[model samples]
Target: MTENWLNQIKELKQAVTHSGKFHADDVFSTALLRYINPDIHVERVNEVPEEFDGLAFDIGRGEFDHHQEEKVYRESKTPYAAFGLLWRVLGAELIGEEEAEKFDHRFVEPLDYNDNFGDDYVIARIISNFNPTWDSNENSTDAFWKAVDWAEMILRAEFEQIFSRIRAKEEVLEAAEKAEDQIMILERSMPWKKHVKDLDLLYVIFPSNRGGYCAQAVPMEDGYQELKMPFLKEWCGKSGEELQELSGIPTLNFVHSSGFLSAAGTLEDALEACKRSKELGTLNEGKQPVLLNVSHGISSEWSKEQIKAAHAYGEIIDFMLPKIEGDISQESVENFIDDTVAKILATKASVVYCDGETYLTYGIVRKLKKKRVTVLGACHNLNHEFVEFVELK
Candidate 1:
């Protein structure tokens, strides 16, 4: 049995409701209605008047109430609270049918479960927290309205993220089509990692924000629990001059401890590392690895003059000092350097170059060296100094 609530909602000048204590269902229902038609007003009431004119909900003896002997249940047998009921009738009209159904499953289903079954779901708890406490001096109606504002913001942000993922999918598909047999080289970085699971690729090479290219081994499956072909264990946990000497690839920068990823100074060197990895895989089987000539340069930083000079050497990862207004404490500077190192590590940068101002601080250089990440600093006019050459226990 369907109510003509859709058409009835349109004629109502304001949403008439019972107030005092509000539940998630009532708050969400009011929010959704207001979002659909911003001009509609909300008038709280204690009793259902005999000659009620506007749309009545929650406490009123109207079609929106679920407290009566008759109840509403979705196809899945979950009881529909006021929010679910309203969503079922009018959700598709606001959003498309497919998205509305998806939203109901992802967002509305849990709320309905908590409202009907007395479950302590997070969303229900969040809405309940907005209520005025017993000792508080705030008005109940004001508190209820505050929760409505938060609910609207949550809904809008979630919808935006969902649509963004949909658009990213198209870009991933196009890249997959043109990808090499065992590797995919993306010109720029994006949220493409999630969309490449089913493709028959082993490695993904892309330009890192830290400068040079990064060669990341694609996991055998989702969650990256394991890789299709990991970098050779011989170079694991090694970086800087040592990594370059061991690999005999002058441009090699770092190899993670797990051997799942490695970095190179240039695209050519990154691809060479990939080739070496495949060779090791084949040598273990008494076979030869397939070789491919793939090289390209990408950089979000570096001026045209700088690129021309440094392109041959690959990407240069540098950290420069920020301008400070007044005297700075050593503790604060150390904390800042720690945070900067953390951000660079998150990108799995192989080597990081520091400006003379930052390098003058011996402790900061020591901290970067401890991470096993290659650190280069300008010491004097003649040449650049390598922190890797400094011995630290």
Candidate 2:
């Protein structure tokens, strides 16, 4: 808020805000203002003294307070608490327009939501805990300042990490510019996942700390397990000479069973292996694997941990996971078998995974075994699940 009061507050380097049982809004507002100008004086009171001409927020129903009838909300529909209000006016300007949006989404929004609506967030809980206990003799005002100091520390650490990620993104882009072909070789590994998917890369060959080099297939899209191109089906899950004989790369080392990644003896070996995979390898296109979900009567999306476990075997995808309202019949369930098999044939899915009505899951698995697919059962909890793909003709 570029109000006359705000202009004066910047020059005065002092602010006045409400003081009672404090919330994250006021605490972080003070912390952020102190971060900007450490010497700024902050006075808390039951009422913002009328004689006080300096900036007042989180009180007086001024620009930063959220208690007014007409509330302020961001474009995303999240209402602004005092901290969010101040962040939009000041913190965004301090960092940058782009970085500001990302920071607001990841950090600021949760606290704002917690304060405006009733919710439990660890950061908000930590600040609220600083309030003097009902039986404790400790002063509340002094405790407030201590919480502000800690909030400033938390903000500084988080911002520094974001700055480092910014620098890493720049370095990865510079390397991308120098790449000659689909295989982009990095002298050393930096975070390249965010930058590689949209580019024309099929494999990113980088130095592996474990040995010589590693080649990772670029995902077809972000946040999906599908790769643009995967290793040859014959080469997956093999080590040493076996992988060498299959891949026709004498120096080849190993390829993950999922075919999304591989480790090779040398940089040259990585480059050559990827070259051969492109020329001969065809999976998702020729025989690429997928972790198919057949949610016949079950209704649940896989969690990140579940997706991670399934990804070790192949790309995770949903097939015939329909949302059914009425009861199912034997005829309707039986009819799904032919339609499901037809969909699988349309794609070159090698590895299959299923979770659904128990009888249908087993029946589909038996039918898939007759096709060119490897059907496997899941055995574990969400915390730990495993799928060992034993090839079935």
Candidate 3:
């Protein structure tokens, strides 16, 4: 029986190798499936892109009529509403607690929508809430729920195949326990957290599409360039700039370059741009601080110049939260700013850029003011030359 199980494991591993979306447990599930059905076919699961449109959102509307008799209508705005619903459903499935101070990384609640995102910032909120965009127009709300139900049917069948002929519930519980143990060991060994502490300064570059790409596929420049914005030129370029002039300084230690050059690229390419930004930073000799960036909404090819400069710097990426959002208030943005400030404090990051006002929320500005973190807000209103520098009070 052990030999048969080993053989099944081998087959499952092969299936996972071929299946792009297969996670570690998927391998175990595959092995179990093989045991249940000798002729089971291992097919790769299709994963929808995290950034997609067409999500159906339902916005409750009230009865109002002027020219005609008032009649109640179901105002369907599923795209927006979907974020809340998806978070409720999918957020519940994440694995919580691993190696922690409590017990082998205490299992936090599952990475639900709220856990992954917050109302403080809209972009993070949107991404955390919505992963798979639903085709709301094609299917009614009831139909979508029905589809979910049908999907679960396939899931159960797959689960049965993966579990094999397990006669007792206790055995299933044991398997779960063993899996949890392995996860704890892996979480503690993550290198990013350790290095953040060791490094003295971190440079984060947010790539913008200003001159990088035309749509999502076209390019403006051949490669990235050094920080040449009027603000960077004034701050990083100045020899005897005042603390007031340096007010535009997002950081005394770090530099930044972000804005979409173009929009014509794969999500993978966008993610890779973040990786490249870190690499570029490493070229500079020093503490080798971390450099981070996000991908989405690029404008031109020349923008690659910034991404290339970031690559030369050898940047380190910690979090890859999606740029998601909803109609959020200044208070919420401020709270997010405070939370991010806490994270920066924990890492002991001294000089940090708040990016710019384009992506900067009023909440973030207020948080910086309270914490005394130096940040610069690029004022496009002033020929892109003037930067509103915020000093911590």
Candidate 4:
């Protein structure tokens, strides 16, 4: 490695040394590992660095309530994870036992057929070559990644604590009270970047109770493809294969029969639906971005007073993108989505609403007008609310 690479590795080592404590803020190490192996399975083990695979099988300890032990363990058996553990071991070997132990508690008790080992034992086993049976299975990548993520969480917690201390000191220190005043000054003025890379883990780790699932297909190669179904085959298409083959092509029955989009549920469900749709590669692949279609949620049964109340909220005056946090009202979600449609269309987007008014949200109209994304108001119609979708040449 070059000087810069060596420096980075050194820093990485320092970060990993303080990886034991469970903290929510230390996302950097996890981010680095993800950066290193974007979509692979690898647990961040801090042991030998060269000889053995760190992950040993442990079916006896059973499952834990918070952690998805079984699922994670399954991932730990993948080939990618094995390779990652080996990589760590190789690196550890080069650094030697004494130096490696200084950074982490992985020097002794490398690997065994037990789960009672501490975190250090886990790391050591990862980098040592103690067993061939352990290497027989090929699923270490997931566990390795989990380790990386865990370490990062610890690091972030430590950093936050440090920041809290600095802030506490600054209260009475003023400008010249301390020798490191200049450093403090720089720290205070520095542009801080938000670390939200692990937002996915947030959703995954703490999933909401309420959710709805659907699947659709997008054109790839010659035909179509589908993935991720949460509904029974009866409610969906003819069979799993048929559902998987469902497409969002112009001719197909694109309308969703179920009222998942407008149903009473947690925001978690809504977000999950959108994300699942994106993952399935059915729509919104940076090209032909389709409006997530939903119509059933628009209830005529709602009293006029309720509807008016939802409309009168100041923050939601014209059209607003509802922030997905806290107690989100149903009206807020509906209007926000409607507004998003108008906004996109106002920018020249060709939006096609499934069965709801596409112009009710003025914010959407404004944004759409600016972007020039063509808008298509396909399904339902509402009174009075209008956003200019076309501009005459």
Number of the predicted model whose lDDT against the real structure is largest: 2
Model 1 alpha-carbon drift over 4 Å, by segment: 1-18, 32-65, 68-77, 86-106, 133-138, 279-393
Clashes of 1: 0
Give the best candidate by TM-score. 2
Question: Residue 91's C-alpha lDDT in candidate 4?
Answer: 32
Q: What is the per-residue lDDT of model 4 for residues 1-393, given as tens digits with 9 covering 90 to 100? A: 323332343334222211222211112223433443354333333332344322221111212111124332222232112222222343344344443333222211122112222333443343332222344653444344455555545534544554554454444244223312111111132111112121111111111233322222212111111112222223232323333344322211222332111121333343333344344422323233333222434324332233234222111112223336677777886677666665534543233222333334334434543443332332111122332222211
Candidates 1 and 3 compared by TM-score, better number: 1
What candidate 2 gets wrong by more than 4 Å, as runs, is 1-12, 49-54, 245-251, 283-393
Prediction-by-prediction clash tally: 0, 5, 91, 59
How big is the positional error of residue 371 in model 2, measured in Å on the Cα after superposition? 20
lDDT of each: 0.68, 0.74, 0.30, 0.30
Rank candidates by TM-score, best first. 2, 1, 3, 4
How well does candidate 1 match the true structure in TM-score terms? Answer: 0.56
Task: Give lDDT: candidate 2, residue 226.
Answer: 64
In model 4, the runs with Cα more than 4 Å from the true position are: 4-138, 175-393
lDDT of 2: 0.74
lDDT of 3: 0.30
